[model samples]
Target: MTTEVSTRPLQTLLAFPFHEDRWQSKMLIGIGLTLAGMIIPIIPGLILMGYVYQIMHRVIVDRGSLYLPEWDNWGKFLKDGWRLFCVAFLYSLPTLVVSFAGMGIYIVTFIGAMTAAGNHPDSPASILLFVAIGILFLSIGLSILTGTLTFLVLPAALGHTVARDSFSAGFDFTGWWKIFRANTGGFLIALLVITGLMGLVYIVSQIFSMTIVLICLIVLLPLAVGFYVMLIGAALVAGAYREGVENLELAELKLAEASIVAVQEEKPS
Candidate 1:
């Protein structure tokens, strides 16, 4: 008798070929475009985000990899990015509403608690308690809900569907919670590593003694770091999406192939 192996749950879509040909060149170009996008000043951040979104969708989703043509079709990418931004903005309304509404409730609860405690302004204990409880609830609720939304709803938006349909798709995709749970440790580790690297970059620049280099650093460092961070995030999200979809396709293919093999074996050989 042979022991059977259990099928592991699917991990987040992260299928980008980080080690493949011309990836570094594409990454550098992507970062540069992201930085130039920052020069617009007022809405530069949003524009930069749009650019990153475009690169991810166009290069990763459409091209089947992140090794894209360097600045060859940026205008088209930007257009797609803008379209995605608008859709994502609309999709995110519920999250924004929940955040503000939750904040309002916390404020109201705090005020009520303070009033009940006494008219004394020195009573911070009650306020502290209110904040602690509020933050705890927010952290738990927001992390889980946002994680689920990002994992599920993003696919529909990426696929250019309506908000309601996207949300429904998210609900369906999110039913496989075990996959998310299994990958939690890896996600947390990656998050910490990225955070540490960013912090180190900030710290090293501040400690440098060369005045001219320091001045240049002060101006360019934040933008560089920000762009790089955005690129990494976009890549990771794109990878997760690809991984999920491909895995689903692979499973279907395997089942079909197995069925064909069974039928052929029964017929003659």
Candidate 2:
């Protein structure tokens, strides 16, 4: 008999990074790379994101293993990171397009409003100004909503893509959607847990920032916390995916068994 894989989002979130004997060194490297990425720019950041993707991939393949992976294979990290970037970029395109369009409308209307105000103060210039302001605000709200939804959906998409080792899998909305629907509760819980962890880190960072000496740590502290949080979040997401997929398989199996039973009953009677 096959043992059932259980979902332990909270346990995995808090323990995965520290489960290994060399967790200290591993975490240090991760945090150091994150800081370096912040200082240097694109390349290191991409590599780090790719490393996080590996964590997700590992969890899925290993049936939710809690050990942190060693920081090796720079070439693979860079390549995988590029794929991660592409996935994120494509997902974010809708928000970007909306934002740019809104900005364009706002600019044109603002200019018209100013031009009209200069010539005819009592004309529709004020109305145009109001419309522009309204559009800008509306765009900002839409962008935020779209961006948040994208962030929530991204982990599931990335998990599917990473599992298949295919960049195109990230774009398979119908596929991921089915997986996501299978365990929406699990995904939402993971999201809430990660969000809470980040919020707690932010609060602590703010407290540290208040001190003169500790204020110096504001930069390093958040980076370290954020890196760990990323690892934890990735693991949680992968676990959720595993649970969701297994649930789907089990459901299908039960359906098949029921159909077989029904067919046998119909034939004999």
Candidate 3:
């Protein structure tokens, strides 16, 4: 007999992190690690990221289990975190290149416009200014669009990488796209859920900022909120991935293949 797994995105996203018996302790540890990451920079940050990757991995393997893993394996966390960082950095390259190129062009055009205006106001300085402004807006628009698309697609890419336990898996665009297309709605809902939660966190942080006495919390609050949000986001990714796998019937196929391999190995050996 097998237990049925629930891949309902809303429930998974909202309840998974808190369903465990030691949830508060786990959350506090996560928050502390996150705060330490922010305070100490690169190494701690990578470990935190790796820890989040483990969360995603657990969800995917266990079919969205509610139990959080203890933070005992620092070495694994560091390695996983490094893999995640590499994948993220590679994905972000396009956006970074576009943004830098746009900024460079904007700076040149603005300087040209200013030079024209100073040298000859009656000349095509107005034209140059208009061109500069247009370029600026276009650059800004393109950057935002590129960045937004990257943001939306990255979680699935990360999920794939972790699922396969290979960094190269993240670059398997075709595979991830099929997964994304199979359950586009689930992915979008996950994205929207994350965005809404992040916005709420920002608002709460801002409210805390207004209170002078709680000024110290203004710094710590965002870090804690961001880590918690990351956990929720990771769970959502797992849920979406589970739904995608089921929708594509990959899980059963893999299981059948595994059973066949096991039988063949037993008979031959």
Candidate 4:
């Protein structure tokens, strides 16, 4: 049976990383992933993303804590990372298209206006400028909204994807809809926890980037804030996934028992 105790989401989610067991080493992995993630041709970042997903998988499936996952599964990590990349990429398509189109429109409008001004054309440059501003704002707002949706849905998609060990699992829209419907409150709470962590990371980093000494800290520990926030976010999603699976499992067990009892009732006494 799934453990129903320790239901406090944040507390349970953080218990692993905060535990007294080799937390320093776990932190070292976080730091390493963060710094390595900052480098180059997307490989390092993808690996780190896969590793974090594995950490979430362990928690949600194996009922493990937020302990650091090992780097030994490089092949598996690459594969999983590739799939997660697919999921994220697919989900971000709308946001990407909107953002690029927005930027393109802004650039074209800026250049056209500049030429008009330089040539002193009779066209209403002022009106064009106002129209450009409105278009820019609207496009930017749409991009931001879509980007936010990507962040919100990616976690749920990732959870399902990893749970089934299939990339297509994440795209199972009907299944996800049911899961979301059944666990809306818990899922929102999880999202809220992650959002809070985001704000905290921003505040802490700003505080750490003030003086020369602190600015140096930020430079030396460039990935610290990001890694910490990511770890917590992964854990919150893991907890939410576990809760959803547990509910489904419990319902299945009850249904099985009910069927057995009904069969017995139909049998001769």
Q: Which candidate number has the best TM-score?
A: 2
What are the lDDT figures for the candidates, one per model? 0.55, 0.86, 0.84, 0.77
Better of 1 and 4 by TM-score: 4
lDDT of 3 by residue, 1-269 (tens): 99987768466557767888788998898888877876688888888888888888877766656457788999999999999999999998888988888888888988988898888888877587788778878878888998999998998898899889999999999988888887889899889989999999988888888888887798878877888788888788877886787777875688899999999989954
Candidate 3 residue 206 Cα shift, in angstroms, is: 2.2
Task: Encode model 4's per-residue lDDT on 1-269: one tens digit a residue.
Answer: 78676657556566656664677776777677668766767787777678788988897778876677756787787788888889889999999999889878987887788778667766677466666777789899999999987776677788888788889999998776566655667778888977887787677778888867787676554477677767777777877777777787788899999999999999998
Q: How close is candidate 3 to the true structure, as a TM-score?
A: 0.82
> Model 2 Cα RMSD, Å?
3.9
Residue 254 accuracy (lDDT) in model 1: 95
TM values, all candidates: 0.54, 0.91, 0.82, 0.83
Which residue segments of model 4 deviate by more than 4 Å? 1-9, 249-269
In model 2, pairs of residues that clash are: none
Q: Against the true structure, whose lDDT is highest?
A: 2
Better of 3 and 4 by lDDT: 3
Candidate 2 Cα errors over 4 Å, as ranges: 1-9
Off by over 4 Å in 3: 1-15, 19-22, 250-269
Clashing pairs in 3: none
Which runs in model 1 stand beyond 4 Å of their true positions?
1-43, 58-65, 68-75, 86-95, 112-216, 265-269
Candidate 2 Cα lDDT to native = 0.86
lDDT measured at residue 64 in model 2 versus the true structure, 0 to 100: 54
